[model samples]
Target: MKKLTSWALIRQNLSRKPVRTGILAVIVFLFSFTLYCGTVIGQGLSQGTRTTAERLGADALFVPYGYDAKVQSSLLRGEPSSFYMDRRFSEEVRQEKGVEKVTAQLFIATLKASCCTLPVQLIGIDPETDFVVRPWMASAIDRPMRDDEVVVGSKIVGQVGDTLTLFGKELTIAARLEPTGMGFDTSVFLEIDRARRLLLASELGPRLNLPAGLDRNAFVSSTLIKAAPATDIKELVNRISQKYAAAYNLDFVVVAGMITDMAAKLSFFSRCIHVFSGVLWVLGALVMALVFSALIRERKKEFAVLRIIGASRSALGRIVMREALLVSLSGAFAGVAAAMLVTTLFNAYIGAVLDAPSLEPGPLYRLAAAAGALLLGLMTGPLACLPAMRKLGRIDAYIIMREEL
Candidate 1:
C-alpha cells in the first residue's frame, strides 16, 4: 500500500483554504510584531538608564534646593536653565570630611544656533580642578584644550576649528567628546576663563544681579562631589548639609545620589511593557486556538474521506499540524519584517523629538528578541492543534462519511 504523504497533503489543504490560512497567519503576524517592538523598547530603556547614570560619574550632585528637579530635567532633557550659588558654598563643601573630590560647574543656556544650545550644554570648568569632564575630552582628542578653544559633544555638528557662537562669542572647537547617551553628548566644555567671560556678556549676567565688579568666581551653577572610599555617601550628604545649615540659608538641595529616580522609573516602565506583551501573547494564543479548532471541525468530512481511502488517523493529524505550522511561519515572517521597518523609522527620525537621554540596545539584544519571537511563533502551531488533533482521531468517522455521501 502507498502511504499518505503529509507534506503534499499539507500544501494542498492550505491552498484549498487560502482565506482561512491567511487569516490565521495575520494573527500570528500581529503577535510577532508586538513582541518584537516591546522587547526592543524595554531593553533600550534599561540600557539607557544605566549608561546615563554612569556617564554622570559623580557620587552626589549639590545644587540649590528647588533646582534639584530642574537640574535633573536639564541633564536628562537639556531644558534651558540658569541657577547660581555663592562661590563660598563650593569652598565650604571641599572642606567637609571624607569628601575626596569636588568640582564646580556653571551651566549657561543659549540659543540652538548659539553656544549652550540645549544640545550643547554651555559649561565652564577649571582645567586644573576638573576631574570629571577632562577624562572624556582627553580620550577623544590627544591634546588638552587651549584657551579660546572648546571641546564639543559627539553629537554636536562640527569639526575641529569650526567656530560656534556662544554668548555672542565665536569660539573654536578644539575636540569632540565620545557620546555617552547622556547630557554630555551635547555638552560644550570650555576653559573656565572663557566660559566666565561669555556668561558675563550674555543676558544671564544682568539677570543674576551681578556685583559692580562682575567677578566670575563669585557664583557657580552647581557642584559635583565624590566621596572617599569606605565613606558612607548618605552620611557625607548629611555632614555637608549640617555645615551649610548654620552659615547659609537652606536654599540648596543636596542630591546624594546618581540616576536613582530615573532608573527606577524606567525599570517600572519596562515591566509594564512586559506585562502588555504577555497580554498580547495571550490574546494571540486564544485567537490561534479558536480559529484552528473551528477549522478542524469544518474539515471532519475531509478526514473521514481520507480514512476510507486507507489514510491512518495519525497521518491525517500530521496534515493538520503541518498546515498550522505553515500558517504560523508565514505570519511570523510578516510580523518580524513589519517590526524592523517600524524600529528603523523611529531610530532614524522620530527618536530626536523625544530629546531625552537614550541608549540603543546592542545588536546582541535585538537578535535575541528576533530569535525568541520566531521560536514562540513556531510553538503556537502545535499547541493550537492539540484539541483539533484529538477530535480528528476520535470523531465518529462513519457519521462524517455518511453525511458526505
Candidate 2:
C-alpha cells in the first residue's frame, strides 16, 4: 500500500465533510465582507470631513439672511445663483474688532459650462485683495489670470490650457484645483472683473434680477471673513450682526461649526455601522467554535483508527488545523472580492447617504486597505480554532472507539 502524503490525507478529510467546511467558509465570508465595508466607510468619512474644512479656508462666512438656505445649497451643489449685497459693507465688516480680513465674491450661474452641458457655478474673486480663492490655486496657477481665463475644478474633465466656452465667452483653463470633495470640485474660479464683464455682456442679465443700472463692482453675493487672533468667534459674529444692522441680512456659516457638525454626525454613524459588524463577527466566531467542536467529536472513530496506525495526538490536531485554515483562507478571499465590488458599484450612493462629499481615496491608500483586510481575515481562522485546540489533548480516542464497538 502506498503511504498517504500529508496533502492527500488533508484533501480526503475535507472531501469527506464538504457540507460542514462550506458552511464555515460562508460564515467567514459574510463576517469579513461587513468588517471591510465598515473600514472603507470610516476612511471616507475622515477624508470628506478634512477636505471640506481645508477647502473652505474661511473662519467665518456671512451671507444674505433670508437666503441662507439658498447660499448653502449653491455651495453644496455647485450651481450658479444670483444674489447681491452692498460691497461697501465689506470695509465695515473688516473694521470690526475681531475681524482680520474680509473679501466678497460674486456667484454667477452659467449654461454649458460643465462638460456634460449642465449649469456650472462660476465664482469671481478679486485678485488684488483676495486671500481665499487665489491661495488655493497658488500651486497650480503661476501667473495672473487674464480676462477670458478660468481655473477649473479637479472634477472638470479637462487639463490646463483647455478652452471652454461659457455664455459665448471663451475661457482658457489656466489651472485646476485638487478635489475638495464638495462644490469646489465643480466650480470655475476667475477674475472678478472678468466675471462682471461676462455677466454684463450676457443676454441673461435682465433675468438675473440685477438692479437697474447696477454697478457690478459695488455688488457682491457674500462676504468671507478671517477673524483676529484670540477672538471669540461667537462674539465676532455678534459684532458683525450689530455693526451691519439693517444694512445687510446676515447668515453666518462658521468653518469650525461646519467641521464639527460633519465630524460628529459621521463619527456617530460610522460607530453604529462598526457595532453592527462587530456583532456579526462575534456571532460568526461562536458558530465556528461550535462547528469545530462537533467535528472533533464525530471523528473520534477515525482518530482512533489513525492512532492505531501510529499517528500521534499532535498529528490529529494538525489535520484539524489544516481544515480550518483552508476554510478561512477561501472565505477571506471571497469576502474581499465581494467588498471591492460593492464599494466600487455603490460608493456614489453611499457617499450621499453618509454626507461624505467624495469617496475617492488615492490608489495607494486603497491598495493598502485591501491588503490589511486580507491579512486580518487570514488570522481570524486560527483564532476561531483556539477553543477546539484546548480540548485536543484530553480527547480520549481509544475509549471512544471501544464504546462505539
Candidate 3:
C-alpha cells in the first residue's frame, strides 16, 4: 500500500466527513464574501468623490437663478437639460476681484439624438478660456476641437471619426474621453461658438422667450470660475451674490462645498458597511468554533486508534490544523472570486442604488483587498481549531479506546 503521508491523512479525514467539512467551509465563505464586497464599495465611493472634485476643476459654478439643483443633477447624474442666461453675466464675473479666470458653457439637450436612444447633453466650451473640460480633454485629443467637431465622454455610444447629428446639423467625433464616473461621461463637448449657432438656428431658441433679440454671443447656460491662489472663496461668493444676484438672477454652486457634503455622506455609508461586515466575521468565527469542538468529540475514537498505531501527540495536532487550512483556503478562493465577478458585472446598478458617483477601484486596490480577505479567511480556520488541537494533544489512547468499548 502507498505510504499514508500527513497530507494524505488530511485528505482522508476531510473526505470521511464531507458534510461537516462543507459546513465549516461555508461559514468562512460568507465572511470573506461580505468583507470583499464591502471593501470594494467603500473604495469605489471614495475614488468617485475624489475624481468628481478633480474633474469639476472650478472654485464655483454660476448658473441661472433657481437652477442650482438642475445643474447638480446634470453634472452628477448624467441627466440632460437645457437652459440659458445672458452671456454678459459671464463677462462680468471675469472682472470681479479674486477671480482668476471665467469660462462659460452652453447647455443644450438633444432629443433622441442619432448617437443615443435617449436625450443627450450638449456642452459648448471656449477652448481659450476653458479650464475645466480642456485639461481633461488633452488626454483624449491632441489638438483643439474645431467648430464642426466634438469630443465625447467615455459612456457616449460612438467612436472617434463617427458622425453625430444634433438639431439637424452633423458633427464629427474628434475623440472620446476616459471615464470619470460623472455626468460628463454621457455628454458631448464642442466649441461654444458652434453650440451658440446650433441653438440659434434650432426651434429651441424661440422657446426661451429671451428679452428681444438677444444675440448668439449673449447666450450662456453657466459660468465656471477659478479663484486666485489664497483667495477666500466665501468672500468671493458673497461679493458675486451682492453684485450679480439681483441683476443677473444668478445662483452659485460651490464645487468645494458639494464635494465636502458628498464625502461626509459616503464616509457614513462606508462605516455602516464595515461595521456590518465586522459583525458577520465575528459570527462566522464563533460558528466555526462550535462546529469544530463538536467534531473533536466525534473523532475521539479515530484519533485514539492513530495514537495507538504510534502517531505522536504533535502529529495528531498537525493533522487537525492541516485539515483546517485546506478547507479554509478552498472556501476563501471561491468567495473572493464570486465577489469580484458580481461587483464587476453589476457596478452600474450598485452606483444607482447608492445614489452616488462611484468609480471602480484600480487593479492594485483590488489586489490588496483580495489579499486582506484571504488573510482573514486563512486565519479563521487556524484560530477556530486552536482549542480543538489542544484537546487532541491530551488524548489518552487507552482511556479513549476503553470508553469506546
Candidate 4:
C-alpha cells in the first residue's frame, strides 16, 4: 500500500513540474550519448587491430639477415621496402621437422611510369600456394599472370589491357586485386621468374641473356614458412638456424611474434580508451546529480505537503528517485539508439579515413552500455534525493501548514 501511494505521489509531482522533468530527461540523454561514443570508439580500435593481425597470416616469417627493422617497418608500417635471402635457407628450412610448407617470395621496388612515377613495391610469388596472401585477389581484369605478365593492386587505377612501364620494360597488366589496406594495396605481383629477370636487367643496365638451360635466379629474396603449432614452429626455426649456422647467413624472422607485439600495443590502447570512457561516465553521473538536486529543491513545497498528508520520509524520497529514474531510462534509450544509427550510417566513411575495415558493433557492447547507463542513473537518483530527503525529514509539518494558511 505504501509503495502504491508513493508511485501515485511521484506521478502527481512529475505532472506539476513538466518542464523540470523534461530538463532532467535531457541531461540523461546527454550522459548516455557520452557513454555511447566512448564505447563505440574502443570497440572500433579493437576490431581494427585484430583485422590487421589476421591479414598477415603466418605463424612465423623468415626474412634475410640484418633486415629485421626493414621487414618490420615495411609489413607493419606500410612502407616500400626490400630484402634478400639465399635460396639455400629455403631448402634447409624445408628439411626441418614441423614445417608444413615453404614458399619463397621476392620483394623489389620499381618505379612505375603509368601510375605517375610513384615508387611501388613489386612482389613475386608462386601462384600455386600463394593463396595465403592473395586469398581474395580475384581476377578483376584480364587474367592471372602468364609469362611476362603482372597483376596490380586495385589502387593502381589501371584498366584492362593497359601496359605499365617499369624500369624501361613494358609489361601488360594481367589483373588487379582488391585493396587490403596494407602496402599490398599499392604493389604489383608477378611470377618469380619475371621478377628475377627484371631485377637482373636493372642491375646489368641491359636485358641480360640467360645462359641456355640455366636460370640465373640462384637465390630468393625471402622464405615464407607455414609450420604446425606455435611451439613446434619456434623449435623448427631454431633447429634450422643451428644446423645451417655457418652455411647460411640468412635471418629467420617470426611474423607471429611481430603480430603478437602489435596485438599487445593495441590492447594497451583499448585499455586507455576504457579508462577515458569511465571518466566520461563519472562526469555524466555528476551532471545528473546536480540536475536532480535542483529539481528536488524546486519541489520542496509539494514534498512538504505530501509529508504532512501522512507520506513517510522514505515515501517522499522514493517519489523524487522514481522521477529521476524515469528520466534517465528514457534518455539513455534514446541516446543509445541515436548513437547506433549514426555509427552505422557513417561507418564506411569512418573506416576509410581510419585506413581500417568497417566495424560491426557486437552484442556485448550494447548490453554493457545499457546496463552501465541504468546503474549510473540509479546511483544519480539517490544522490540527487539526499538533500530533499534531509530537508523533508527535518520539516515541522504543523508549522508549514499553519504558516501557509
Which residue pairs in candidate 3 have backbone atoms (N, alpha carbon, C) closer than 3 angstroms, thus clashing? none
On lDDT, the candidate that comes out on top is 3
Among residues 3 or more apart in sequence or in different chains, the pairs in candidate 1 whose N, CA or C atoms overlap within 3 Å are: 65-252, 65-253
Look at candidate 2 and give me any clashing residue pairs: 80-109
Q: Quantify all predictions' global Cα lDDT against the true fold.
A: 0.72, 0.76, 0.85, 0.64
Model 1, 179-252: lDDT tens per residue?
66566666778876677777777776666564333245567777788788998988887777777844543343
In candidate 3 the C-alpha lDDT for residue 1 amounts to: 80
Q: What is the lDDT of residue 247 in candidate 4?
A: 61
Candidate 1, RMSD to the unseen true structure? 4.2
lDDT-based ranking = 3, 2, 1, 4
The reply for model 2, stretches above 4 Å from the true place, is 1-20, 73-83, 117-119, 210-217, 341-349
Each model's TM-score? 0.83, 0.86, 0.91, 0.61
* TM-score of predicted structure 3: 0.91
Model 4 C-alpha lDDT per residue in residues 213-286, reported as the tens digit of each score: 33357556667778866557677778776776456565667766765665666566557666765775566556
What lDDT tens digits, residue by residue, belong to model 3 across residues 53-143? Answer: 8998899999888889888778876788887787888888888889999999988888879999979999999888999999999988989
Judged by TM-score, which candidate is best?
3
**Model 4 residue 16 lDDT score:** 79
Cα lDDT for residue 161, candidate 4: 74
In model 2, the Cα lDDT at residue 117 comes to 63
lDDT of 1 at 78: 55
Positional deviation of 287 in candidate 2, in angstroms?
1.9
